[model samples]
Target: MPDAGHPAAGAAGGSVPHRPARLPLVLLRSPWFIGLTVVTLACIVAVFTGPLGRPLDVALNLVLAALDLATAANAFSTARHFPSRPVRRLALGVGLIATIYLISDLTEAVGTATGLLASQETLANVTIVGSNLVLLGLLLRYPTGARSRSDRLTFWLDAGSVLVGAGVITWCLMLGPRREGWSLEHLATALGTAVLLAMVAFAVVRLMLSKRPPLARAPTIWAVGSTFVLYASSLVHASPELLLRIGLADDLASSFLMMVALWTHRVQLRLDPDILRRRRRKPFSALPYLAMAAMFVVVVFVVPEGLGMRSISALGGLAVISLLVVLRQLLAFAGNAQLLRRLDRTLVDLRAHQHRLRALLDHAYDITLTVDPRGRMSYLSPAVERTLGVPPAALRGSRWRTPLHPQDARNLMRAVPALLAAAGTTVTWQVRARSTDGTWRWLEVVCTNLLHEPAVCGVVCNARDVTESRDLHDRLRFQAFHDPLTGLANRMLFTERLIAALTEVPEKPVSVLLLDLDGFKEINDVWGHHAGDTVLVTVASRLTAAVRDQDTVARLGGDEFGVLLVGTDRAEAERVTERLERQLEEPMALDPGPAEATVRVVAGASIGIATRDGECFPDPSPPVDAMLKAADAQMYRRKRLRRTGGGRQTGRG
Candidate 1:
C-alpha cells in the first residue's frame, strides 16, 4: 500500500522518495492559472484604454504593481519547494527583483499623477535600471546545478557592464529634459553606445564557451528576457517608437511568464515533509541589491537634482519613495537575520536529539550498528568497542566483517541482502564472533530492516554476548541425566536406553544384569557412612571397568547396579556374570574421612540376568519395565544363594 501523505507512490514507500513528477502539469489548470488569466485580462484592458492622464496613470500603475507582486509571490513559492541552497538563492533573487520593480513603478505613477516630476525618467527610472541589471546578474547563475567560481565572476562582470551602459545611456539620451546641455548628452550617448556594442561582442563570446545548459532552461531564459523588457521600458522615453504604456504592459507579461517558468524545478525537487512549516530563508547578499537601488534613487532625485526644487514639486514625493525603499531593504535584512537565528536554534535542537539517540543505544542490550548495502558498517555505537574489545572506527567501512568467525561467515553473508529487504521485520541467528583477545565469543544477533529511513538507510543490528549463559545451560543438561558421584548414566538415563533397545529388532540377542552388593551394608555398620560411600564409588568404578566399553553401567540405587550386554547368547551371559562375580570378590581399601584411619572392607556381587534369545520368550521381547522386574527377582534369588555359600550360577533365558 502507498502512503496517503505522498503525492505519488514509491516502490518502497520511504521518506525522501523520488520526485513527484517531472513537472506539476496540474498547475496549468490550478488557481494560479485563473489568477494569471485575470491579471492578463486586466493588463490588456489597462494597456488598450483611452488617455495618458492622471487617472489612467494611477489605474495602470496599480495593475502593474499587482502583477509584479504576483510574480514575486510565485517565485517565492517556488523557492519554498527547492531544498537546495543555491536554487533558493536564485529563486528568491528573481522574486526580489520583481518586488523592486513593483515599488519603482508605483513611485513613478504617483509622481506623474500628482504633477510632481518634471520628467518621467527620474531616480525611479534609475531604480528600474539598477534592478534590471541585478536581475540579469542573478539570471547568469540560473538553475544552480552546474556551478563554478566563475559563475560569480560572470555575474559581476555582466552586471557591471549593464549598469555602466544604462547609466551612460540615461545621462546622454534622456538628460535633455534636465538643465544639463546637449554637449553632455551627445558625448554620453555616443560613448555609451560604443562601449555597449564592444561589451556585447565580449558577452556573446563568453556566454558561448561558459554556458552550462540548465535542466529547465526556458524559465531562466524568459526571466532574462523579462529583465531586458524592463530595461527597454526604462529606454521608453529615449526611443520614439515604443510607447510607455505598451512597454510597461509587455514587461508585466514577461515578468509573469518568468515567474511561472521558475516552478520548473519544483516538480524535480519535491518538498521535504519535515520542513513544511519552515520559512524559506533569503541570502544575505540579496539586501545589497535593494540598497544599491535605493542609493540610485537618492542620487537621481536628492543630491544631483538639488532636492527636486525645479522639478514640479517632486522633492517631497521622491524623498518618501526613497525612504520607503530604504526601509523595505532594512526590514528584509532584519527578517533574514531573524531566520538565521532560528536556524541556529534548530541546529542546537538537532544536536540534543543526537545526544538522546546515543544515550539510548548505550543503555540497550549489546552493541548496535548499521550496515550499508555492501555489508560494510556505516555507523557503530560506542558500545561496539566496549563489548567486542575492538574500536568502532576499526570495524567501520569494508572491514565490517573482519571480526566474523570464519565458520559462520558464509551463512550470515548469504542472508544479509534478504534481511535488509524484509521492509519491517527482524531476523535472528547465533554465531561465534571473534573477539579482540583471540577468542571466539558466542553472540546472539538480531538484525532489523531500517532501509526505508533516510537517517538509517540500511540494516540495524544488535549483538549481545551469551557465552556464559550457554555454558551454564550445557552443564545443567549434563547433570540432569548423569550420576553425581560415579559420573555414569543414572537410573533415568539407563531406563531410557533400555526402552530404546527394546524398540529395535531382536535379531541380536540382549541381556540385562541386575546386581546387589553382598554384605555391602555391613561395611557401613562397622566403619561409618563415609567408608560405605567410598566402597560404593570403588564398586561402581570396578563395574564400569569389568564390562566392554560399549556396555552400559548404571547406579540403580543404594548398593545395586545394572548392566546391559548387547549381542549376547544364553552361554555368553553366564560367562559374563561369573566374571563380574570374580571381579567384585577382591577387597577394596577406603579413606573414610579426614583424620580417620583406613578400613579395607571386602564385598561380593549377587547378579541376576535376563536374555531375549527368542527361545524362552515369545516372538516379541518383553517391555523394559517387565524385563527389569524379572531381573530383580532373579538377583534376590542369587543373593540367597550367596548368603548360603551356594555355587555361582546364571539364570537361563
Candidate 2:
C-alpha cells in the first residue's frame, strides 16, 4: 500500500507528510501555467503602478484578457485530476462557474482596451454571484461524512437557510447600488464572499477536528490561504469595486493550488491508488495556522491599513461566523460517533448468534450442512466427522461433494437443483456417502430450501446413517421367500414360481419335477428328526448342484422336493431328473448332536416328471395345484415299482 495521503490508501488511514506544491516548478514545466503567471504579474503591477500612461493601463487590460483564457485551462486540469468523485464533480462545477467569471473579466478588459462594449456591470455582477456560489459548493462537498436518511431532511433545511440568506443579501445589495447608501452591488458581492469563506472555514474546522491524512490537510491549508487573500483584499480596501482586481488574483491562485493538490496526490500514489485505507487521528498542528497568521500580519503592515472601528467589527463578525461553523461540525461528528457505536454493537450480537446456532446444528444429527443457491457448501456441521468421517474444516465451499460415492454423487447433482426449485418444499432421499476410511455408507438425507430466511439463506440438509436399517430390510425380505431348513424356495414360494413358469411356457417350454425320498421315513423313526434334517440338507445341496443355475429347487413338504424349470423341453427335464436321483442316493454325513457321534445317512429319490409345451399347456395357463397333483400321482406309481423291483431300482419316468 502507498502512504495514507496517497490515493492508494483510499484516503482512509495512516500518516504521511504533506508536501508543499512547488508553484515555481509548475511555472517552469508548463508553458500555460508560466504564461498565466506572467499575465497575473502584469495585472498586479498595473494595480499598483498605472500612473505612467493610459498605454500602461491598456497593456494591463490585455493581460487580464489573457488571464481569462489561462484560468480556464487551469480549471480544466483541476477538474480532470481531482481524486474522489465528490471532489472531481465539485471541481468541474467550480470550473463551470469560473467560466462565467472568466467571460466577465475578459469582456471588461476587452471593453476597456478595445472599446468593444458600452457597459460590463451586468457581467461583473454575474461573476460576483456565480463565483461565490461555486466556492460554496466546493466547501459543502469537502470530506466530512456521508448523509444518512435520518439527517437528510435536516441537511436540506440548513441548505435552504443559506439560500435565503444569499437572496436577502443580494436584494439589499442590489437596492443599495441604486440608492447610494452602501453600494448594493459591493455589499452583495462582499456578502457572497463572506458566506463563501464561512463555508470554507466549516470544512477546514471539521477536517482539523478529526484524524486526517496529509492529503486532507493540504486542502485545509489551501482554504486558509484563500481566506487570507479574500479578507485582505476586501478589509484593507475603501471600495469593493477596487477590490475585484486583487480578488481575481486570489481566485486564480485558489484554482492553481487546487490543481497542484490533485497532481501531488496522484503522483504520490503512483500506479496503485490508495483511496480505501481510513485516516488516522493526530493532534492538531498549530504551526500552519501560526505561519499563516504571521504572513497575514506582514501583509497588513505592507498594505498600510490601520485598525479602525469598522475593521474591528468586521473581524468580530468573521470570528462569530467561524464559531457557528465549528459548532455545527461538532454536532455532526457527535451524531456520527453515536451511530457508529450502535452499528458496532449490532455486528457483535450477530456474531454471537451465529456461533450459538452452529453449535446446535452440529449436534442435531450425524451430519448437517447448508448449500448455497449455486450448490456450494456454505456450512458443514461438526457431526460430519462421525458420519462421513470428514473433518469439519475440510468441507468448505462444495468440497463435500468430492468424497461422495460415484453413483450417489450423480444422484445428488441431479436432485439438488430440482429440490431447491421446489420452493418451500423438502425432499428426502437415500444416497451412499463415502467415508474417510474409504467405505461407503448409506445416508438418508432430508433437505429443505430456507433461502428466504435471514438466518439460513441456503438449503439446509440433515443426513443420518441408514446402512444398517437397509441391510436389515433386505434380510427380512429374503427370509420371507426362502426356506429356513434347506435354504431353498419354500412350498409357498414354489407354488408361486410354478404358476409364473406355466404362464410363460410354450413361448418358453415349462417342466416340473417332484420326488420323494425312498425309505426316508424309516431312517427318521430310527435315528431322530435331527439326523433326518441332516439328510434333507445333503439332498438339497446335491439337487442344487445337479440342475442348471436357472432352475428353482424347493422343499415341497416332509421328505418331498420340487424343481420348476423354465425354458426347458421334455429331453432337458429327463436329463436333470436323472442327475438329481444319482446325487441324492449317495452317502451323507450327519451330526446328530454335540453329545452323540456322527451318523452316516443315505437317501434315494422316487422321481416324477411333468412337461408342458405349446400343445400340452392350457391356453389360460394351468393352475399350480393341477401341476402338483400330476407329479404326486406319478411319484406314488414310481414308488410302488421301486418296492416291487430289487436293489435300489430307478423309477424315474
Candidate 3:
C-alpha cells in the first residue's frame, strides 16, 4: 500500500500527477563565463605586448584570431535559431565582420614575423576598419522589439558614432603609412576622430539622463566610451612634450576600460547565472599572460628615450590593477552564488513546514475552505464531509452559492463579490446551509482573502456548524421570558406586552387588570406545593381561555396575575373583570374521587384602567412600569372597599 501522505498512484480510477522539471546544475552557475574569460585574456595580452616581444606577440595574436573565429561561428549558430528575420540578419552581419577581423589578424601576424608581404600590414589595418564599420552597422540594424520611436533614433545615433570611429581608424591607417606633409588623410583622421569623440560624449550624456533598463546599456556605454578615450589619447602623444600629457590620459582610459569590462562582465554573469554554469571548462589564458610579460621585457631592453620609462611604469601598474580587479570580481561572484544557495535551502525548509501544517488542518474537525476572487472553492478540507455531509472533492471548483439555502443564497452571492473586491479583508456572516442529508443547518462562517500571498493565491473560509448551539440559546431565552412552573408569561414578558400596547394604542384605551386569587395561600397551606402547581396551571389555562388572544395573561409571582387589554374602554374592562370573578367563584375540582371532599374555592380579581393620547405615549418612558403601578394602587383600594362592607359595583361612571 502507498503512503497516505504521498500523491495517490495512478490506477484504474486515479488521476495522473505532474512532476516539476528539474533545473540543470550547469545553468545555475553563471551566464557570461565564456565572454568574460575571452575579454580578460585579450586585455592581459594588450598589457604585456611590451615585455613578451616577438614569440609572445605571435602567440597572443594567434589566440585573438582563434577567439574572433569562435565568436563569429557562435554568432552564426545563434542567428540560425532566432525567430526574427531582422535580428537574424544583424547576427549574420556581426558574424561576417568578426570572421573578416579574424582572418586579417592571422595574416597580419604571419606577415610581421616572416617579413614577406610587409605591405599587408597597412591592408590589415584597413580590413580592421572595414570590419569595425560592419560590426557597428549590424549593432544598429539589430531589432529591438517594440521600442519607442525615440529609442530607435537613439540606437541609430549610437551605431553611427561607432561607424564614425571606424572611419577615423581608416583615415589614420591611410595617413600613418604615407607620412606625406599635411595630407587629406591626416586631416580627415583628426576630423573623424573629433566627430566620433563628440558622438560618444552625446551617447554618454544620454545614458546618464535616460531611465531605462540599465543592465544592458550602462556597461555597453562604459566599454565603448573608455575604448574611444584610450585610442584617442594614444594618437595625441607624438613627442616628449606632448607624450607626458597624452600618456597620462591614455593610461587612465586603458585602466578605466579594463576595470569597466571586468565589472560589466561580472554583472552579466550574475544576471544570467544559467549560461555561465553550462560551459564544459574555463578557457586557457596563458598566452595573454606571456604576452604581457614580454611587453615588460621589451620595455626594459629597448627603452625609447624621453618619457618611455613613465609609459612603461603606467602600463605595468594598469596590468597589475586589472589582475586584482578580476580576482575581486571572482570572489564577489562566489559569495553571491553561496547566498543564493542558502536562500534556496531556507525556502525548501519553509515549504516542508507549511506542508506539515496543511496536513494537520486537513484532518481538523472544522470545515476549512479556500476560494478564489470569484467565490469559487479552490480547496476544501476533508472535514467538509463530517460537518456538512458534503465531500471535499464535490465542493472543489463549485461556487459557494450552490451549498447555501435558497433564501440565503441571494444575499450571500451579492455580498461575496463585494467582499472579494476588498481582498485581504475578513468578512463574516451567518448562513443557512443545505446539508447533504437534505436538512438545513446554520453555519457561522468567517472568510479571509489570501490574495496578498503569492503562494496561497486565493481566499479562505473557516466555517463550523453552530445550529445546535443557536437552538439551545434560543430555548434558554424563551424560558427567561416565561414562568417555568405555570407555563405562562412571567413578569418580564408581561411588562413587554404592556409597554407595546401603551405605545401602539395609547388613545384607544388600554386596561391593566391586576388579579389576586382569594384564599390561594390557604389552599397552598392545606395542600402540598405540587398541588399548588397544579392549581396555578389550571388558573393559567382558564385566564388564557377568558382573555382575547391579543391580551397578555401573566403569572406575576405567588397568587397574583396581570393582564393587558388593548382598545378596551373602562366599561368593557369592568364587564370583563366581573366575568373573571364569577368564573373563579365556581371552580373547585381536584383529582382522586373527591365528590364529597371537593374543595370549595372562591377566587376574586381586581382590575385597573388607564388611557393616554397616542401621540403623548410616542416616547413613553417605562410605560409598562407606570401602568402596573397605577393598577396595583387601584386594586388595593378596591380590595379595601370590599373588606369595609362596600357592595360590588359593576357600572363604570
Give the TM-score comparing model 3 with the true structure, all chains together. 0.47
For model 1, the stretches where C-alpha displacement exceeds 4 angstroms are 1-342, 359-365, 370-390, 393-421, 427-444, 451-454, 466-475, 496-513, 545-552, 563-586, 592-602, 607-624, 644-648
TM-score of each: 0.43, 0.47, 0.47
Ranking by lDDT: 1, 2, 3
Clashing pairs in 1: none
> lDDT tens string, model 3, 362-433?
778778887654557778888888888888888888877778888787777566544555446678988898
lDDT of 2 at 463: 86
- Candidates 1 and 2 compared: the better one by TM-score is 2
Per-candidate Cα RMSD to the true structure, in Å, reads 14.8, 13.9, 20.1
Question: Which candidate gets the maximum TM-score versus the true structure?
Answer: 3
The TM-score that candidate 1 achieves is 0.43
Query: Cα lDDT for residue 210, model 3?
Result: 34
Q: Positional deviation of 547 in candidate 2, in angstroms?
A: 3.3
Top lDDT hit: 1
Q: Model 2, 573-621: lDDT tens per residue?
A: 7788778877877888877778989877778888887767545444547
